[model samples]
Target: MPAIAVPAFALAWWLACYLISRDPKRATLRWQAAALVSYALGVAAWTMAPGSDTAEILLCVPALCWAGAVVALLPLTPTERRSVDRGALALGAAFLLMIVFLPQAGRLVVLAPLVGGLTLLWRLRAQVTPRMLPAALTVMTVLCTAALGLLLFTSGGARAAIAALGLDLLVAGYLVAVAHAAETGERLRPDLRRALAAGLAVVVLAGIPAAATMFLVPAHDGVAALQFVVLAAGATPAGLGGQVRRLLDRLALADDGPLRSDRAALFLNADALLRRRQHRRLNTVGETEFLRMTRRALHDFADLNRLARSPLTDLPSVERRLAGREDQPRARARELRAVLRESVSALRPPGPFGTTDDWRYYNVLQFCCVLGINPYARRPKTDGMSREARLAADWFRRYVPEAVTKQWIREGAMIVAERLWSEVATRRQELPAGPDGAHDTQPVNG
Candidate 1:
């Protein structure tokens, strides 16, 4: 089982590394991938020389790799990418010191990575929200700490199985954490959030019996404890099945308000425009295609009002600007204007613009001017934007005076709108009829 476990873990880490490597934007995943690669190497080394002292020393590689992953997960400032390198080096140094101290430092070495991860979590508690990943990590940490204590203080067949279970929990926790981090920009629906919470609650409830069996039942062996934990974890999903169904029914009955087909259409158009930019394939060069592109770009401009309100803004700068300022009429006016300017500047595409980049800025400016989104307003005229987005709207506004006149912006927007109407009409005509023989002329939402 040990031999199989080594190879299985190695293969899983290798696959995870491969998938994470494909996306450059996944900084945390990249570090985790690197850690897994390191771990795989250590496993291979230990497998080749299981009995050797050198092989045992090589196990430190996985420990360092785990520490590296924790470092990667730290919430650093936006400008400070790759801060994990310094943290990893420091951790490596600590590991080396522990080795030099030998027998006396053995327990310290085991505790080091665990302590580091928890310390980082503690420091970032304010920034970290109460989410699925963090909750899983907390549980995993507690289990791991207990497992470590058992290993140091006691030893037997039960210890090995319990240790294996703890490792499994840690691996599961890491996977959940990475998945959550990857989708940090996504907003969770209320129903989904409730479902997740309920699922977790069920798991906790199932574990209570297991905990009682382990601690209260004095005659139970290590094997019995291990069995109970496994059974409890496994039974959680099955036990929650009825509750899950009820939650689903409740969710279905809940009103989600009217569908904004226009917003959906704009998102689709923006995606199409981005794809065209990426592929650099101008399949057709005509007035119609140009107008289509312009229409998409204009939609993107309008969408910027929502996008700019992202929580990724320079929060410190914002705080500083608004600090100690009362909400008096004059002060409120100044704050609004400042935020509007900031918001507009946030929408500006970085680097030099030509025909290639010009469309983005043009779209944003045209949308702001034509849509009549007040440059000095505290909030967007439209509702439904997230709090982060509203904050962005509060800080930034459009800049339209540079290259084009207001007249040109307005005219260009109208031209795009006219072209969009014609294109939609053409598409509706081309669409095939439904089964009942009536033409299904509903336009694509996005």
Candidate 2:
């Protein structure tokens, strides 16, 4: 067989495996037969193509057709999406190898259709499964290996294709695998954490070897190793795992609202509670798309609370007054102590996610959001005693009466303190008590 024919066959084989795995009904035997037929004809045509075989293009045609059919038939699950892209990448690598080994194999005709199909498949499989993705990539790696063999045997023109395809597959595979592990949630299943950790370990181990080869292996030999490392890192998981951690942390603030298993809303019954002022039994909004909207609600609440307080007060000056000098606000802060005392009494110990300090930060952030002042705003570095309290000082100066500005600042400080206290209290309440059960009320800095 001509040098290019080998890659053509390999590409068709990889697609055959990918399609079999993803198609609703595994048509492994049928697709494999079709792929073999196509490769056979393409090789025959290439052998007969005037002086050189341009017939390799035919191998990809049937593969593309089958992939399209599979895409149409399969339900667009996340696993299916990942599978499609991975399979396509593998096929593409095989095709690229053909171009490298056998120079005159009608490059665009072979590559263009392959790339187009892959792009279309990627778009279609947008909601892919973490598991399916790495699996597909594995198939691609095997095809790339065949191409490398061809390169080592061939003398010129095709060497770069061998090096490039090998490296690309190595890197792409690792990245895909890493991402999948990181994205999968440990909390979803007791074993999920172990699975994720194990997957990451594999990538790490694989990465070290691959990375070493990238630098140590000559241009051709090292290419495969380097590509593998790149893939491992890129594919490290993100979506579900990251979101789960965030949800757990937010749940610790359930008393601020309420926490439920449903991820459809952010705070408990926030949507219904926030809308009409009925304020019936407290309902939770769960961790849904509504969380983002709730953040906006917090912003609006601040504006309204500011406006309703002291109608005669100057808006800017009131903000400054509320955020005023510490001493003055501290003295007046005692007035509101009673209002918050009950909430403090109900507080539970901190949970695994945060400590008392973290709770305090959360409340400070909430208070600032409610009052329309950016909590993160920086204080003046050079300004001495007078300008130190930019946040609390400015808020009190603008909103609280001049007589109460000092007290407002103090009250604000108390709010921050209570938040931490309540946060720890809640954490302790969430978990069962015992030596094995940790009641950590620590702050999460990130």
Candidate 3:
């Protein structure tokens, strides 16, 4: 492999594992991992053994994998999702059989899946895109178009080199972008900015030295060795070092310190809950801005993967649960989510929901936390508040520590988001099924 392909393949593999590890139960990540692995193999065969029977099988598999992954990532109905999945399998089996038995026909048959995948994308253009992600969707469209254009125009060794690399980049970029959109919607802007800067940094630090080795070294294999050495020497300190820092930060957040009043830590500290470093800090953002910021997060809860980070992960209760196993951030997040649900459920009031006497406790959590109802605003949401609710709000305003109230908001929002996301992200039947079991579009086949 070329020195550049080494890093490209390594990154693709690492990112594939990262996405799967986030939530393996999600079919989207599994399909994406399959695509990456197959695409890497397909690129290898295309550049090295384009004429062989084995190479045709290799190309056919990745094309199916790529199309299946795109269908999986979209916010499609479960029936639509399952239909495409099974259809892809059926078609892939037939395509490989043709490649094995009918050599000349199968070479032409392999392109069927790729064209089908592209056509499906064009048809589902409206449904596939998540809100506020038009730019990312546009990038994916260009990649797909470019991959086809590159394969059609290039010929000979140039075709294998350029077209193969284009397909590799296209698959990798599409999956990564989709995975990121799933995690953080608005937060993706800063993440992309950071990624762009890091990519440029790698080019400067690793690419320059590796490029020099091509001319300086005499033997071809010797040059490849030097390129790897130079690339690692540069990447280790600049790239790996930052990853190490974030990893350490994630795993070592277990400070089993006492909570206020010397109680065992059941939730986050005052400062951490308040996001002291960010503008959302209670003291930094006045009551108005605090309400505005919290409102924005609540409004966009469905797009985000997890609740805003809570200090509940540090609870000694959580520590006891993880005593035997390794300290993983993923485990901590799962435990914290469950605990937050139970914690908020305890505050539910008796009787029907309203702004009345019995509803004070639960509604306090509702207004101050989830709704961001600024009672003291110039134009507060107090018109709907009943007399008992108003008095209860005053008591909370006077007695509750501002930071602790902030903590409650964090916990309350976690509960609300968990419920909201269940509705949005659940694989339940959304749009009504059609006569054909929602497989309006069939998987591409020979």
lDDT of each: 0.42, 0.36, 0.47
| lDDT digits (tens) for residues 86-176 of candidate 3 | 8877886777676567654435455566556556665666644443344453455455445434443444443444345444544444544
lDDT of 1 by residue, 101-136 (tens): 565227436447746765776677555534345556
Q: Kindly provide the TM-score of model 2 when superposed on the true structure, using C-alpha atoms.
A: 0.22
Model 1 alpha-carbon drift over 4 Å, by segment: 1-3, 22-25, 79-88, 104-110, 145-166, 169-446
Candidate 2 per-residue lDDT over residues 2-22, each given as its tens digit? 233333323333323322221
User: What alpha-carbon RMSD in Å does predicted model 3 have with respect to the real structure?
Assistant: 17.4
**After TM-score superposition, what is the CA distance of residue 179 in candidate 2 from its true location, in Å?**
19
Minimal lDDT window, size 10, model 3: 276-285
Candidate 3 stretches greater than 4 Å from native = 1-26, 40-61, 79-84, 93-105, 114-127, 131-154, 157-168, 171-186, 195-305, 309-446
**After superposition, which runs of candidate 2 have C-alpha atoms over 4 Å from their true positions?**
1-33, 44-51, 60-63, 69-113, 120-130, 134-446
Count the clashes in each prediction.
Answer: 13, 79, 0
- Would you estimate the TM-scores of all the predictions? 0.38, 0.22, 0.45
Candidate 3 local distance difference test against the native: 0.47
Q: Which sequence of candidate numbers ranks them by TM-score, best first?
A: 3, 1, 2
Displacement of the residue 399 alpha carbon in candidate 3, Å: 47
